[model samples]
Target: MRLLFVFGFFVTYGAVLTATVNNPWPNFSGVIILWFMIYLITAPARRRREYWENRRALQEEYWRSSIRYQNRYRY
Candidate 1:
């Protein structure tokens, strides 16, 4: 299912590029900039950053505690 979708997407994208790209370099560069701007506009900011930081901190603490527990048993 995922492979079929990927193939279909590439086929559509290639057709568009063929029809539109008179100057291939500039056209491809413009497409890349357009996608980058779309990503910047749609991506979340502060809340997502805080959530990820908190999750990372929790994971680090878990690993540290587990290592300490193992060392205690070894001695």
Candidate 2:
């Protein structure tokens, strides 16, 4: 999903850039660069989100296994 979004972003940016070749008033590079900078800045937060999600999944799996172990030992 993230890959798709990144790909879409570059594709859109390229398309807009190509479309603006005739006009020289509004420069899109700055806007695109700004957005790319924002994306780079927010990368850490995205990684943290992914980390937390993975940790939560692992914790859930551990609890499930613990519960099964306890149940198996209960005679």
Candidate 3:
């Protein structure tokens, strides 16, 4: 996480420097646009990962309870 923050800092700063050197506002926003695009692209994958994680956890709990119930009723 710390490394990610440092990398992000350098990337944004580097973009700013590049834009300033070129003096183009439209292209300057390209860095922000690129990041937004990346986020949009990954959103689905991220949600899918979370969905499966939750499903697995719920299934585990369900089976645990089922086993406990069966044991309680055993002769």
Candidate 4:
């Protein structure tokens, strides 16, 4: 999926660049809009990935602390 996004971006960028070679203003604006659109499209996926990473870290910390507490109380 990520690879697809990257590939698509490069392909679209190349096409847009070629198509707008004679028009500098449109070329610049098109590239900017393309980047913004890609960012918006990927925002949800990025958020979800961050959320899972944070959750995993919290779970690992909880387990580590619990194990340490148990060991300290053991006779």
Pitting candidate 2 against candidate 3, the one with the higher TM-score is 3
Question: lDDT of all the models against the reference?
Answer: 0.63, 0.74, 0.72, 0.74
Q: Global lDDT for candidate 4?
A: 0.74
Q: Please give the RMSD to the true structure for each candidate, in Å.
A: 6.3, 5.6, 5.0, 4.5
**Positional deviation of residue 7's Cα in model 2 after best superposition, in angstroms:** 14
lDDT of 4 by residue, 1-75 (tens): 986879577657755674654665435556666677777887999899999999999998898779676697687
Q: Give the TM-score of candidate 3.
A: 0.52
Ranking by lDDT: 2, 4, 3, 1
What's the TM for model 4? Answer: 0.60
Q: What is the lDDT of candidate 3?
A: 0.72
Looking at model 4, report the run of 10 residues with the lowest lDDT sum. Answer: 20-29
Task: Sort by TM-score, best first.
Answer: 4, 3, 2, 1
**CA lDDT of 8 in candidate 2?**
68
Query: How do the residues 1-75 of candidate 3 rate in per-residue lDDT, one tens digit apiece?
Result: 974785587557657655754565435466676666667777999899999999999998898779676697677
- TM-scores for all candidates? 0.36, 0.47, 0.52, 0.60
Location of the lowest summed lDDT over 10 successive residues in candidate 1: 18-27
Candidate 3: 10-residue stretch with minimal lDDT: 20-29
Candidate 2 residues 14-72, lDDT tens each? Answer: 64664566785545675577567767987999899999999999998898779676698
RMSD of 4: 4.5
Model 4 spans with C-alpha error above 4 angstroms: 1-8, 11-21, 24-26, 68-75
Which parts of model 2 are misplaced by more than 4 Å? 1-32, 68-75
lDDT measured at residue 29 in model 2 versus the true structure, 0 to 100:
70
